[model samples]
Target: MKNHFKIYISFLILFGLTSCSKLLEEVPKSQVNKDQFYQNEAQCIAGLNGCYDNLTDIFTHNLFKINEGSSDLAFWALDDADASFAISPANPGVGDIIWTAAYHGVMVCNATIVGINKSPVAEGRKKSLVAEAVTLRALYYYVLTSMFGDVPFYTKEVANFDDLEEITKLGRMPASDTRNYLIKDLAEYAPALPQIKTSLIVGNRVSASLAYILIAKMAMWEKKYDVALPALQKIMGIYGSLQSYKLVDILFRNKNIEESILEVQFAWSATGIRKTTLVAAITTPPRTANTSIYDGVEILELGDKANPSTSITPSDHLIDIFNKYPNDIREKIVMARDYNDKWFNRPSRDNFEGKPWMGPKFWAIQMDNKLDGNNQKVFRYADALLMAAECYNEIGNEAEALRYINMTKIRANIPILEVYPGKQSFFEELMDERGRELMGEYGRKWDLVRWGIFYDSINNTIATENEKIKANLRPYHEFYPIPDEEVFRSKGVLTNDAYKQ
Candidate 1:
């Protein structure tokens, strides 16, 4: 069956109907019906390109919104008054789009690898491409697992309905299991990925440090400090240094020239990415402002046009978490209230008349907001060291933990505060730094979930805000409720219902 598989065997490879596999692998990328499309090197690369599109979609689409929001920074921010306690099933199918897009990415990676193997290209180049695909697919699963826990773990694209059902119902692998899968994938692929020039920004599309970030996340979840150490050690030794802090850059716009690890690709475009522009993820400098742009603010507005893609703002609790940063970078990160021209440009200059400006970690746009401006970073070195610090703390290596913590601080030019600052627990201090540094970059909710602080924070926010409806903000929200739609197809095998809410 493996030898007989041919992605280019048919003419309808575009429909994602079948896969090409060697050695009877169960998951290839989305079933690319073997067709003429798989016959050439260009076709193989195109398929890989499509897979890369899935990653951008995740950030620009639904998961990035909810996953970040419901975690710590926000309540659902829904127009519906009933959303305060959004029950098991929520949303009107946007999550479905995310689900489709995520699997679609995985499928592309699977198919690309299979097609590469079948190609006539040299094995070395082919292997390099294969490494990138695996690293990307692994990252895709990491996102999928973060959003909808226990996603079907398909490594090869299944062309047959039987195989689809079998794989789909395979149930949620323990979170640990899915994490291990990605960890292994990154470890295998990271070395093969090239050392990318920061400005050039695209290589085989994955880097060694990026892999360490993923492994650091996996180890953090598994509480495997030792297992996670070598990866961070690799990162620290090679690519994990933090960019020196510039006060103006740190306060007004947050981007670490040095710390960035993985970044979703974006080109400066006048028109803008429909997803990012609407969601406020993209920013421009003043000279290049584009007004017709429906900036994320217009999209995030409450009345009728709230964006489905906005990177939700930090909650009051998140604001309080950084209360210690009175003059520190985090307070200046975003406007406590709406701010206009005089302040937006020099936000670090002790401002007033504030509205919700983008958080400091993310640079707000230029005079006229457009998508072509700021770049979104996926992995940064500070996160790696912080992750290492967490693992070190858990393993009771206080010295190692302090080293990583101080390293991130020294880069930010933050004062070298104790890991256990007076009255602040070590874990509390760590969580605070995570909020202050990574705030809106997409890891807050995960940190809250892993730290088991959602209930305390969300409930407190609701009480503080006098929010109309009350949500349990339970552990289930920690991992989005696996879409009810996926559950229906699982034949009772894969269900979020089984996990005690």
Candidate 2:
């Protein structure tokens, strides 16, 4: 009975592997029994922390990165992108991280739920644990549905490794089936969940408000407009206000933002603690020695945390998108110019020094590391308003569409969005607004893909990249190659076209 959190997670992964493989007839080699664990409340909380730690894995980042890379919101590199070693991505459209991360999150959820079900904790605490588990499960399932199209749904504890093998044998579950599972569980648990009272940095378990937002999002994805509207209304009551303009620090902090409906919980409280600063380090200006700036490489005291190899730079298109939207709040979202770049004509001309690109959203880690405090916002109020406007526009309510779109502009103190009397092509304007507002946030890619802008933009990017370098383009490149290991491992059962490595 070591009672260490690390040991708990080790066993958790084993339980998942054994269950997926069907090789464990009894107990998987990877884990200990419930008798050996969950002896007390502290242990249970530690186990929950272990579950939260699962997101720190590479898989999660990969799955989530698709929201940025595959969409028109970002391009691989600019005409002058600094990463000299940027290679053409296989499944150049989607990354391989999703394949592993989604499954990993699902596995963690399975183990945690199993632990909660068997734990001796009070029924009230058990319910809280269940609520957290269900929300997280729904999130991972949401990612899987968005990426792979369909995935199996498992709610019970896989007693051992062998149970894992049994489920992997079944191929993809239909998208409708998986999404419905999310809605069912979220609906049951959300009402009992409380609102997150603290800031974002601390991993607040599933709050009622967060659950409502997530449920609303899932409903919207399924096109259940009536169901979605009510959930959104619930969230509006809790966190409807936009993040204030002055609390720029709020955006940079790891704590709960006034705008954040939900965020993945991550922490780096101990040594070897991993944080989400990969994008920051990659995009920060390369620090030459003796420079005052803490570029990603310079900041990492151990080995340079900067994966200068797979860097994320602001594309020229992204910069142009920002410029097109005059005086929008998104400009404050990411800072690119020297203190001042425009209006170089006045007496204070050239007063502020601007770099080719630098944005606080990506680079804020320079000041503090929890890279922890800064959450990658999964659901924010801005998205809600945008979606409402898009919906209104679709219904030919130009007046109503402008009403929602103007909300964002109003907050930014920019010229309010205008709608023509016979306004058409609202979708086009929505896409345009998303690029400027959500650039580098990782949601743009899906927005572009869903809107059918991927093929044209991807081809344009490939042609542009290949013209300068040398790489063959293929239609299949749109999806990332299924990892050969996953293909071979899942071969006996449940293999499908997406896994055609």
TM-score each candidate.
0.77, 0.77
lDDT of 2 at 343: 21
TM-score of 1: 0.77
Each prediction's whole-model lDDT (CA): 0.57, 0.54
Cα lDDT tens digits for candidate 1, 217-300 = 777777777878898888777663455433344332343354567666544434754424233432211221223223322321
Can you tell me which runs of candidate 1 are displaced by over 4 Å? Answer: 1-44, 75-77, 80-87, 90-94, 196-204, 243-258, 267-277, 281-313, 336-357, 360-374, 418-424, 469-472, 498-501
lDDT of 2 at 449: 44
Prediction 2 global C-alpha lDDT: 0.54
Q: Pairing residues by index, what is the TM-score of model 2?
A: 0.77
Worst 10 residues of 1 by lDDT: 299-308
